[model samples]
Structure formats: structure tokens, C-alpha cells
Target: MAPLESVRQELSQQFPCRKDQIQVLSTLFEASFPSPPTTVVHGLEATGKSVVVRAVLQALDVPHAIIDSKECITTRQLLEQAVAATRNSVHQALGTGLLHGNQIKCETVNALENHLEKNIKDVPKFVLVFDGVDRQKEAPMTLLPGLARLGTIIPNLSIVFIITVPNPRLLHLPGTPHIQFPTYSKEDMITILSLDPQDIFLERVDEERYDYGEEEASEDKAWLWPRYCAVVWDSIGKGAARDLRTFTLICYNLWRPFVQPIVDGTHGTRDFSKLLVSRRSIFQGDEALTGKIISAKPSAEDQNNRSKPTFLELPYYAKFLLCAGYLASYNPPRQDKIYFMKSTERKRRRRGGNAGGRASKHRKIPRHLLNPSPFSLDRMLAILQSILIHPVAQTGQISAQIATLTSLRLLLRTGAGTADLLDPATRFRVNCSWEYVSSLGRSVGIELRDYLAT
Candidate 1:
């Protein structure tokens, strides 16, 4: 085991967001150094189990052998590998002549214990690290229990088993002191991810790096790197499994799309924040820049002239279904049309048509300002069929499209209501923008310009 101070120092340098784990592990290593009770370290994948344990052991300058149990097929193979690793470790540290022979075969537990005791006499203790013990259990290898009993079987030797299993009972090794590493919470993840140097590279890039007249009053905010890293974690890291390595990898990959242009002056970074928030600015551009050229002789060429919306890539029927749902939700019924009427009767006198409802209902509201209202699935389907120019949309096609939309969160099912009691009725609401809905409608030859408020 290593000195407590040095172990803590190494941990702080290499591992972040695991102060509690590091503290406890440092104590364990210090107390168990030179000789150990069987120690089992288990946690979720990528929780830094192997890294922490190995770091502490190395800090203490212990003679240790690390082997992955995954490569061992049987008890014999495990024993051979562990003994070989231990032999190699001892041979390197103490040189030749320490053991009777350099080649020590471990065919039995007794022979292994005898070999370890005789060969590892030079070091204060010998650490045998078995990584991926869960794999060894699956191999049904009979070596784990024996290794767990190493404290009594051999003196001056300790065994460490690293696993991903949460329950120590699963390993069937009773009385072994097991150290559990919990998965990182979102806040913990953010803290750890913020410390990564991936985002710092962008801030410190040669061309983009700026110095404030004084350290405290620099035009570049000191918080920019942390804030940027936080946004990345919130945008992409949170959705994935809480693994530091994986999160850092995602942030690394995002540097080009999100940070490169800003550094290269191809695009400005001031307005770029979250992925979705800065999407148009980072990827899309002004209408004039993206507008397609029109041909004087138009023959089936109009489709290519208009700038297609992002949702244009959706399946054909999914597009029409979204447009129909949008109309059904945003456009009120004929009787309630006065609610959305452009002018009141008093105002119409200044203009034209006599508004015939509560005067309050005739308040002018822009179509674009209207929020999507929940509508029955049947009504949406009816609108879809009526607006579809092609008869290819069959019942199966409609059902499949609705399912797709629901999965994509473009259509959401609301609570069921009763009226005629015509089976289990479902209600749905369009969950996207008027611009997107209108684009879909236009793509399918249905004019949605009149249906939307704006």
C-alpha cells in the first residue's frame, strides 16, 4: 500500500468527482499494504474502478501483477496466468535467483501458494489484480474462491478482484470485503466533465485565444469554458450512460461542428450555445444565401427551387400526416371560426363581413400565434385522407405513419374521452412548428398557408 498523502495526491490529479471513493480507497490501500484481506472492487462499467485501485497500488510501490480474467478460460488458465504474472513481476523487481526456477507451473492451489510465498518474499506484499471477475464467474472458474482465501493460504500476498456487478452476493464469495463504486449522478457528471481539457483546447486555440488587458477584466469570460462544457453535457452527455470516458468522447467529437468554425472565423460562436438552439445559425443560413435558383422553363422543377425544411427527410406519409394533424389542431371548427376571425363586426364595418358570435370571440388573432389544440385521431386521419393527392395512403400506411410520428414525438396521444363510445378513442396533438407543418403540406401538394394563423 502507498502512503496516505501520496495516494490522495495521485487520486486528485488523475480522478475527479470521486473524492469519497478515493479517500476510502486510499485508506484501504494504506492499511492493507504489504498484506491484504481479499479485496473485491465492483462498480458499473467506466466508473474508474480499475484505474483508482491500480493508481493507489502503484503509488505505494507494491509489487503487483494485473491480469484480465476475461482471457482466462478455466481455473487452470486463471491460476497459470496469475502465477505467471506474479512470477514476472517478482523476477523484474528482484531479478533472477529469488525463486528456485524462473518457470513456476501452478497446477494446484497448494503449488500456487508455495510458489507465491517463496518467490514473492522479496517484496513487502504481492498484489494480484484480477480485472473482469464477472467474466471469470461466467466461466465457472473455481479459482475465485481460492483467491479469496489467499490471505490464509499464502503470507505477504493479497488478491484484488475487479467486477462490474453491483451485488457482492452474485459473486458467491462470502466475507470478502467488497468496495462498491456507484454510478455518477448528472451533477457529478457535469462537474467531472467540466474538468476535461477537450473544450479548453478550443478556448486556447492560437488564433482564437485572446488576452484581457488585465486577468480580471478580459473581454473573454473566464466562465466560458465551464459554461460551454456544461451545455455539451446537458445536450448530449446526459442522454447517454453516465460514463466519464464516453461523455468526454462525445464532447471531443462535437468540437468540429460546434467549435471549429468559431475558431476558424467561418462562423461566430457568440450566438452558438446548445445544439438545437444554435442549429440554424451553425448549419443553416439566411433565406437569400440558401434560396435555390428558379428555371425560366419550369417542368417538374419547382420542387427543387424552394428551400426544403429540415423535416422534408421524414417518410412521405409521415409528412402529410403531420400537416393534417397541424391543421386539425391549429385551425378551429367552422362554427368556431368567428373565434379566429380577423375582425369584429364593429371593426368589419370599417372593413367588410358581419362577424356573428360573442363580440369577444371576434378578436383578431394571427394564425401563427395560435397554439396547437388537441384533436381526435379520427379527425386527423380524415383530414389526412381528404388532403392526400395520392390514393397510396392505405389504412396500414396511416397506422404506420401515426406510430412513426408518435415515436418521433411529432405527434403525442392525449387522454381518451367518451362520446358515442365508438371503441377506445384516441386524441392526438401536433407537436411541431407551423413552418415545418406548412412545408410538409406543400411537399404533398396540399396548401396549408390558409390553414395556419400567420
Candidate 2:
């Protein structure tokens, strides 16, 4: 059998929904068997790029080295890690005690090449997979090409770079041959998730907790498991990411609630199905509270009574900052506010040579419809002090509170750079809801409605 055929068969069984990517990778693997070239595999997160490559190499029985770029910050660190992985692979393959002695440092690129040549003498052809290549903060431009050129310098060395960036130009490697792994669709995700045969829906009852007439309830649970899974997928599973690992985890947690009812023999499959179709409250709470549970959709009364812990948790001054920002965004300044005016100055010319320019009407934006506007630090502080019931004494403490708010992302900086907050160029904009603003005002014993235009 050809090498590519062998790899294709292994890939089809191990990794599904990746037929095209497997074909591309098998060809690359076949090409690298005789002599290797630098290959870059790029894709989005959770697309299974690393998994496919690892499966292919293992199936082909090719000795490979692995390096995580997050750990390798500098050129020297990259060289050291590469040399270490190479040594470990050699030790495992030949059953040699080559790694037992004192560590010999390989800090430079030349030293790395010499070390590779020495260790890989027995095993001539192998691959080096560098995961997270974009994570290298320094020397990526220099390090990538250098690693690629190692294939040419060494007789049978191939280098593969795994990156999350889809665009090649961002990494400054326009000439590198690349293969992309696309994100999976919802149907594809469902097909992949079904491959797992674990009895996730089976409910095992504890003998000590409660004793019933029946010893086990597998028949009842077996019937309802499929329906419960269908309801869960329709509700939130369709919107989730396409990663198989995450999808399987969600499936397990979603099935946990259905387990107890089946085990205790309190509810059967038919009852559960009716509740799911009528109320659709599976996502709201656990299975025990299915009947007693209210709809996940909130009513007007619920919205009014909703306790915003995030709003209530803020410092006193931060609430004032939010109130000030709301006022600044919705209300126009006096110089900017224009109305009908009678002046004694010279008449301005119109296009038809009229006596005065036509009056342009200024429109005021609705208070509720307004967005949070950027306010200077001094302006925000002034408003804060005026609205605050008790006066704040220290200037340093006020500055500290502003820093705290900025760190918590309640007060976002609106300027171009991270300049000092007190800098005249620096500004801030509050990012919160109108409901939250009013609630904060009420907690401070002030009615924010009075601040808005009628």
C-alpha cells in the first residue's frame, strides 16, 4: 500500500468531517517522506489542526518532535526546547540512555543544527511540530524562516508550524506553503458528537440514599435519553462552537438532570417530553424543578424587580461617574444649542444673495436613545462632587477610585493612548445600561429622571 493511502484510512476512522483536509495533509506527508519542505497549517481555534497532524504522523510511524511556542519566548529558548524534544524522541526510539547525562546547552542556531545532526543520526527522517507559532513575541520573522531552512540544511528534517491566524501575511511569511482547516458547521458538529457511545443519559441510582421496588431503571431511561438530547440540542446546542470536546462536555452536563428523575422512578420519558415541549424550561433550571420552574423569558415585573448585583457592587463615586456620563451624552452644551436669534450684525449672504443665512434647526436626541458620551476626568469629578451627598476630602483617594473603575472596565478610557487620567487629552465614557444608571442613582438617594430633559 502507498504511504498516503495508509494515512487516509487512519484519518477517516480517527477524525471525521475533515476529508478534504486529510487529503491535503496526506499528499504533504507523502511528499515529505522522500525529502521534507516547510509546511504551515493555519486555522481558527477548536478546528482540530493539531489533532489531525498528530494522528497522521502517528499512523505513518514517523518520529517527530514537538515544541510549544508559548514557552519559547526568545531565539535561545526556542533552540533549547527544540534540542530537548529531539533528545526525548531519540531516547524513546532507540532505548538509549543519551538524556541521562548532564545537560549540554544549545543556545545558538548553529548549536541547534549541530545537536540535531548528532542526535538524529540513527533516525534520518522526522518532523518538528511547533504549536502556537504566533505566540512568540520576539524573533518570529527571523525564527520561522530559520526553522524552515533547517529542512534544507539537515538531510531529512521537516518543520510544520501550527498557527491560529488564517492570514499568512500577518506573520510576515508570504512565501510559505500553507494548508487551512475551516470551522465545522452545526450538522457536522452533531455528526461528530454522535460518534461517542458513552451512556451519558443512563441514570445510576444510589442504593443507600433511597430504596425503591425496582433495582434498576435502564429501560425507562433508555427510551427518554434520545428525546432529552434532542430538546437540549434544539435549545442551545445549535448555537455552540463546533469543537467536539466542548460539545461532548455540554451533552454530559445537560443529561445530568434527567438522570435523577429516571433513577428515582418519579417521572418517565412521556412526562419529560411534555414538559420540554410545553414549557421549554430545561435551560432555566435542573430537572428536579421542571414543573415548579418558571419560563426563562423574564416578564415586565421581573425586569422591575431584577437585582443588578454588578450595579450595586460599584463604589459610590463610580455611580456618580455613570450618572455624569449619562447627562453629558444626552444633553447638548449651551454653545452648541442653537435657537431662533435676532442679531444686529451684518447680514450673511446665501447662495441667491439673500439678506441672511437660512436658520438651521437643531434637533435634540431622546434621553433614552442617547449613548454614553466621553467626559473629561475633571468634568466627571466635578459632577461627582456636586451630586455626592457627603463631600470627599482627599484628592489622591479620588484618583485611586478612578483607577479602580478603569481597571474594572466600568469606566473605559476614550482617548487614543493610555495617558494619565488627569491629562487634558484623556477622556472617559461609561459603558452601562440606562436601567443600571437609574438604579445606581436611586441607591445614592438621587432621582436621575430629574437630570433628564422633559
Candidate 3:
């Protein structure tokens, strides 16, 4: 048997902040034989519940079969597969595969019990783990309680159920021990994430060391990474990041960009507040914080190059909404009919005859150069309908898309103290830069210059 301390240490290394759970599991499985009929490791998703249990069982060289009940929804299929898996797991550990017995078919709870009683009861020791047992096509009313009491019938067998929900009453196993894994706290998250601090820059270019390890990187490791995680938690993880898996993915996508400015000497290593201000766009908007990372792996050359993020793809109607919002915000309301309205009237051009007036003395600032002016939703929609080739979609659907844009911070809602969402007076302004909207127009094959009034 592996030393208890070594096994505990191994588990601690694999899963940090799980010392109590590890201690309990080690004590439960490490003994020669066990008591309780069932052990449940339950918690919210991605809290290291299943992984931690699997690690501890492996550390002690325990023979166990972990069946994901989620894969086979049917009760009969689940029962048969569980039997087959249990047999394979036990025989492989016992080196009795050469003398394999006839396969037993178990479709119902009664038959499953009979098979386990006659065949599996004679085994020295065994464990069966069911992950996500609540996900069954057939309601698992009797099967759960049946397995929960299976240990009394077969002393050699121990059963474990790994679940994501916190409803222990559903099991109805009174004496069973429930090991719960709660969602990680921010401090715990920072500690866990900082365990493996990734290097920002890999290559040594032009004599100035770009290491996050020796001098600057040590600070980056100890100081920068934690603050960055705290910022991420504040922006998105507080609500959207339900699990560590998704939270980790978001961090990975933003980490490279967050550190690029520092690597370029645009900001100092100690200017954390400034760094956050500069990189606000990357995390401040719902679009960046909730968006998925591109799946394509960066090439070696591309990875070496300091590449900035490109434009993320938007929905088709969303493109039109953005373009229309830009036009409505920047162009004067007086010129709306001239550019947007369909007409055949030609007007005479203005002659530069040196007219003497205060207007001529003062050069008027271009509308595009000034801050965006708020426009009514109806006017923006009218502009959108005129430009779009396809018929304007349902009003509710369009409204929902506009709300999505607002949440993304692409468009700012200028209305306040208003309860009616569809009020004619509700106004919004484009929150994007001129160059950005120009690029968006190009992508959609629309020349924005033709529609401009300035």
C-alpha cells in the first residue's frame, strides 16, 4: 500500500484547496474494508470534485470504474454498461481476465442486484463511481436508493455518486456522507490561478530581457497576475464564469493582449492602474468578456509576432444596425432627407464668392470630428431599413439585437428615467470610433462616404 502521507501530498499537489476532502476520501478508501453504502462527491460544475476523487483513488491504486451516467440515458443500457465496466475494472486489477466468466446482462434493478450478489460479492475489494447520475432518461427513483444500500448486501463493494447539483434530499440515503465542493472564492481563485503563472514573452530580443521570471517576471508572477485575475473576476467571473473551465478559457484569451503593452514598454511594470485603463476595451465590454477564444492555433511565426486582436464577426442585421447608428449619430438631422430619402430634385451648388458673414469668418467644425449626438431609435431604424437589401425583420427581434449591441457597448443608451423601453423618445449614440465604423462598412461592402453629410 502507498504511504498515507505520500498519497495525501500527491492529492494536494494535483488539487489545491481541497485538503479536508482529500483527508476524508483517503481515510474512507485507504482502510482494508468500509462501512456506509454510498459516498457522494457533489458540488457545482468544474469545482474539481470528480477530478479530485479520481486522483485520490488512483493515488492509492484502488480498482475503480468511473461511468458517466450522462452518456447512456436509458436505464437498461446504463445498468448493462455499468455491469460490464465493473467486471472489466475488477478483473483487470485482479489479473483474472484470462479466466473470464460469461457476461451477465442486467437491464433492471433486481437483475443488477442478483448479478452483483452472486458474482461481485466474492471480490476482495471494489469501487463503482457514477458521474452525473441525475441525468437519466428514465427517472432513477428506485435505482439510486437500491445502489445506496448495495454495500450492506455486498460488503466488498463501495459506490460513489458524483453530482453537480446541491440537492441532497433527492438521494434519500440517510446515512450516506455528502462531500460538497463549493464554488471557489476570489482569493482561492487567485491562489489557484497563480500556481502556474504563464510567461508573457518567450523570446529574448535586443538585449533587454523580456522575462517574467528573473526580475520583471517575478513581479508579473507575484503581483501582476493576481491583480489581472481580480479584474477579470470583477468584470465577468462574478456572474458569467460559472465554472473554472470557462473562467480559465477567458483568462487565457485576454492574458496575451493584457501583457503586450507592457512588453512593448508602452507602460511600466508597476503601472497596474494605467495598464487597466489602457486595456479597458478588452474586458470592459460584455462582447470581449463573454466572447469565446478563436479555436485555430497560432502559427510559430504568428505567435512570435506581436499581433493585436482582429475584428470579431457580428450578426448580419447587427452590421446594419451599427452602420445606421453611426450615420444617425454623426450626420446632421437636417440632411436626412437629402441622403436617405429617395427623390429626383437637383439643387444648385454653392458659389464661393467671398460672402461676408460671421459664419464665413468662423470655420465650422466637421460633424464627424465632434462627439456623437443622440438620435431617436425610430430615426435610426428608418435609416437602417433604407440601407438594408433584405426586408426589415420583426420589430421585437430587431429590438433584441439593439439591446445586445447596447450590452456589448457598441451603442450607448442615452435614455434615462424611462420605464417604457419602446418609447419613441428613447435615444442612443454610436460608441465606436470613426476608423472602426469605417472598417465595418468596408467589410459589409458599403461605402460610408456616400452616406455622410459632413
Candidate 4:
């Protein structure tokens, strides 16, 4: 299959869209004929931006090229490539007679204008499909002016730019009108997964069954159905559903031989630890194991306290999550607390009190110590440390960082452990402190802050 066809097939299987959107884009392509005007489609990653562009091209039966802006090392390089490719393709289709003695000059905006002028004088219409437009670090701001100029200079030449980006804030570019692709809903995700090639799904199902004994498999189809559904739901919720490639990877990992054997024998509890380890490896690789050891190792204070440290080498991502306070105890005994923290003072007091005195006096109630709630400075520091130490190549680490940052700002206002932390005045002060600290220091920027805070 052609590259675009394969991409189209993948998109058709994974993305949720109304038939009308596909029809409209298809119709637009069918009607298109080497036009100079451009339409821009922009959205978050895995939201089907490139797929829509490819679908249109396929429907129109036109040969087009797709380029990723992010992969370009510099703006000038990207512009040079885009201009050269566009000029070469157009010039080839419509010979020198249409050139009218005009040489194509490669000044960013001027080149685009010159191309558009030549196209109008020459070919009926032409399309240039630019994918990953927003990914160019500087092109959006620098090259957009020339692109906008095309609207007035060469109305006949059509351009379709498709951008898949993580930040919606980037859409504020001048003269670029874009259609945003929203994140898929749970129902939409389910529907898309159901439509996935049966063979693919069955492969996952078969892999999941490898550890099951024949007798056990015969008795519990009902239980297995929910397990499959849960896996699908979790996979989608975690952002794997957006891209078929990633989703397939998730399925392969979830039902891999190593995990299935454990799942088949036990009621999923044994699998939890393995799942955590696997997820860490998937997200962090060797770095995660290193982070786990670092986190599990006894802290300096733990050594002085002479208590068995509760810290165990957690998965690096889990440690990151815990540090960011994303993985808080569900319905903790104290609403203000995040994780359970052992109190050295209480332990000391209990040891001293137990030495003598009335039974009641010696038997003082142990005070429970819980980690301060999410958004505490301690948690933020822990998360930041994990990110700094862990390898940066992990998928979803950046998103996880951002989510943690958002959670931190909210938590700071609530105070780490103080009951008075709920006061509006205290919360406001905490927010201001976060803003001030983040603005003044690179270590506390929004991205880092979010990772730590969460």
C-alpha cells in the first residue's frame, strides 16, 4: 500500500468522525484542481489532522506530499524545502510557457507570492498540503505572513496546511483560520476500538488467553468480557486511543506473554505489581528502574530515625506521579493528606512512653502521619527530581509533567497539612507564591512546576 493509503486506513479505523466531515473533505478534494488558495486544519496530536488531509487527497486522486515540521532542524530549512518542492511540482505540471519569463525567487513570503502568481497565469489550480505546520519551532510566526499574503496575491492557487500540536494556545497565529479536532469521547473511543480489524483485536484476545487453563476459560466468558472492556477503556482514557499505532502498542503490551501468564493464574492483584513495573518500563525504560531504586533507598533522615523505611523502589513514572501527588490515596482518612507518611516523632514518643507509667498513660494512641496533600513543595521537589534524573525520551512524560504542574498550583492553595490551609487568604497567598517562584526561576517554570505540583 502507498504511504498515504496506509495512513488513511489507520485513521479510518481509529478516529471518530461524522460521515459528513469525511464527505465534505472528500468533496472538496474532488472539486479541487491545482488551486492557490489554502485551507488550514489544526488540532491536538492524534486528533486526525494528517488523516483528514490524506483522506482528501485520496478522494481527489491527486498526488501530494506530506512534511513534518517538527523534524526540521531550522525554519530556513523547512521554508527552503517547502518552497522548492512546491515550485518544482508546479513548474513540472505547467511548462515554461506559463512561467512568463519570471524566475521563482526563494525569499520566504516573496517565493510563495511568486509561486501563486505563476500558478494563476499557468495551471488551472494546484494544492500544496503542509502537515505539522505548528510543529516548526519558528515557522508559524515567521512564515505565516507570506502564507497570508497568498490570499490576496494568488487567489487561484490552493493550499491546505494540516497541523497537529499539543498546545491550543498556538492557534492564535495571524490570518490562519483553522478547524479544531476535539479529543475523542469515551463512547467514540469505544466505537473506534470496536471497529478495529477483528484480527487485531483477536490477536490481543488470544495473547490474553495464553496463560488461562482450558477449564478456567470455559467457565468465565462473562468475567473476561469486562476485562477486555476495561483494558480498552483505560487505554483510550490514557490517550492511546488517539493514534492507532500507539493503541496497538498498548494492546500488545497489555496482553504480552509476560503479563498474561500472571493474569491467568491470579485474580489480577499479582498482576498489579507487574503492571506497574511494565508501565514504568514502557514509559521510562532503564531510567525508571534506576529512579525506583533511588526512591526506594532510605533517605538521610530515615537512617537517623532508625525506623524501617516505608519507601520501596516504585516505578520511576509512579515515583514521578507520587511526587507530583497525582496518585493520591483514595478517600484518605484525613482529607488534607495526600499519601501516608510515617511520623518519627510519634514513633519516638511511643517508644519512650512504653518504658513505664500507668498502662493507660503508656498506651498513648499512635498519631497517624500522612503526607501533605497534593501541591506541596515537598511533593513538587520529589517529582522534579524524578524528571531531572529520568531519561526524557519516554512517551507521555511531557503530558504527565504538565498535568502534575496544574495539580500543584491548585494544591498549594489548600496547604500541605495545615487545617487553616483552607482559608481563602492562605490559598491566595500560596497561589501568588507559586506564580512568583515560577516566574523568577527556571527550576520552577510552568512545565516543571506542573510536574512537581501534581
Q: Which candidate has the highest TM-score of all?
A: 3
State the TM-score for model 4: 0.43
**What lDDT is obtained when candidate 3 is compared to the true structure?**
0.78
Give the Å shift of residue 26 in candidate 2.
4.0
lDDT of 4 by residue, 87-114 (tens): 5666665554223334434546676566
Off by over 4 Å in 2: 1-7, 30-32, 170-176, 197-230, 240-242, 258-261, 264-275, 284-454
Alpha carbon lDDT of each predicted model: 0.65, 0.67, 0.78, 0.47
**Tens digit of lDDT per residue, candidate 2, span 182-267?**
87776666656655533533445456785522323445445455556565566666566246555556667666654555445565
For each candidate, how many residue pairs have backbone atoms clashing (under 3 Å)?
A: 6, 0, 1, 21
Off by over 4 Å in 4: 1-20, 32-36, 63-65, 91-105, 119-122, 140-142, 164-177, 196-229, 232-248, 257-454
Residues 336-362, model 1: lDDT tens digits: 343223346422122223467434535
* Superposition TM-score, candidate 1 onto the true structure: 0.53
The model with the greater lDDT, 3 or 4, is 3
Among residues 3 or more apart in sequence or in different chains, the pairs in candidate 3 whose N, CA or C atoms overlap within 3 Å are: 212-217
What candidate 1 gets wrong by more than 4 Å, as runs, is 1-3, 31-35, 95-104, 166-173, 199-222, 264-276, 280-454
Best by lDDT: 3
lDDT of 4: 0.47
